[model samples]
Target: MSLRTVARDDLKNAARSYVVLGVVGVFAALVALVFVSERNIYPDPYRTLFDVSFMTFLVFPLFVAPLSYLAVAGDRESGVVKYVLGLPNSRLSYVLGKFASRASVTLGAVVVALLVGFVVALATFENAPNLGRFATFAGVSALYGVSLTGLFVGVSAATRRRSRAMLGVFGAYFLLVPFWFGFLPIVNIGTVLDAVATTFGTTVTESTRSFVNALSPATAYLYATEPVYSGVTDQYPQLAGTFGGESSRIEAQLWFNVLTMAAWGALGLLAGYASFRRSELG
Candidate 1:
């Protein structure tokens, strides 16, 4: 029917996800900070930043991803799909409402956590990251969150079986997201090299530089992680010895991740909306 009516319902459902994710994120962050501080092994700002951002971006998203599965399945389970489908609005509108409402909530929480994490990190760390780098890092993280949430929503919309949908969501996370996070670091050597090349008086090769620019997500993590933690790798060689420059230039790779994540997220939203519209809700 009307957007107002749809929004009201969407808001109610989204609250559940926010409450659950918020509690888990806060508790986990506190525990992690305490545990790391106890070790007293030379404070690593990059690690700390990773701990904080991972909790906010990766960990929390893991839990909230399940919400996408439940949204449509829950409606179907309750037998309300028939009535809702019969409303004056097109299914597209209804689906978009769900996506807009829930995604907004998830996106907001992530943005807040990252900002707060940066502030806390800066105050705590002796070496504060530059503001420009920090902004780029946050943008990349947001795109990642969007991609994570959007895909799950799409999968959920496409399935009638709740368990199947969640499994699909989580399965993709374990298999693909990690590969992107861990391995992509290798290719993202540009920024890391750029910083280090100055010392060597020899710049990384252009092809190798492009690989780093196209693949690495490390810089994204580095920028956000710097104030929060230490040991965040800013760069790496694209390959073992194929003329890929030193890792220092890899920090530049974060922008590639930012754009890629945004592209996936946009696709996910489109898929979710389309699937939701086609869904009979029967």
Candidate 2:
């Protein structure tokens, strides 16, 4: 079979599985939340929605962990991948097509959720947040989600064993993520000093200041709450620090966070694809 033909057929098989259904579930939940939250006192609905989007960080992992496993293990179990590999298609095309189809579905979930969230925020809050910044955040998060999810998919693909794929993804989520965003950055004594200064009236330590600028992605994510822009009707946090904080009134600019997200996402994709490339199909 030709590569294109094989890819088209594989994607069709995937469509019948629970992957698409999971994305639809997440999208629907976000939309439903917007409807119920109409009575909220948010000053910027986008910030509220943005805050809510963090759930994607949690949801995406679960969705991809299992689906990625099935992508390859199922084929292997049925002896179809080997059958297909005998065709004239290159291994690279097969991997790419598999990754693309799976990632596209997950990305679809994120885009649909964020779009619906933005619309509800506009309608409910009565003011639009920084669309550019919001878009930047959305795009970065989507990429990261795909990369993260695709990496897990690749793991399952490589293992050709369903149990191993699930375990791999879960282990990475709990263990690897914490190590990267948690322990690696927690050793910064400077951040503690800085947080102390910001919390209490003390001489602003440059060391602390240094730490603040060098915060980890996970740490930053923990504090990624929308700065409550007070007096802004229908906003989430209702403070002015929602953007990039009090750094010269550039509120709600998530450029740095988005950049970090992009970096992690790229790393995830590269690691997953590279690992998949090295595997010998059974």
Candidate whose lDDT is highest: 2
Error of 2 at 170 (Å): 1.2
Tens-place lDDT per residue, model 2, 39-100, is: 26555555565555455554555665665656666676678778777877766667666766
Which RMSD does model 2 reach against the true structure? 6.8
TM-score of 1: 0.63
lDDT by residue (49-114, candidate 1, tens digit) is: 444454544465565575555666566667776688787976666666666666666656556655
Each candidate: what lDDT? Answer: 0.55, 0.58
Error of 1 at 141 (Å): 1.6
Candidate 1 accuracy as lDDT: 0.55
Report the number of backbone clashes for model 2. 20
TM-score: model 2 vs. ground truth: 0.67
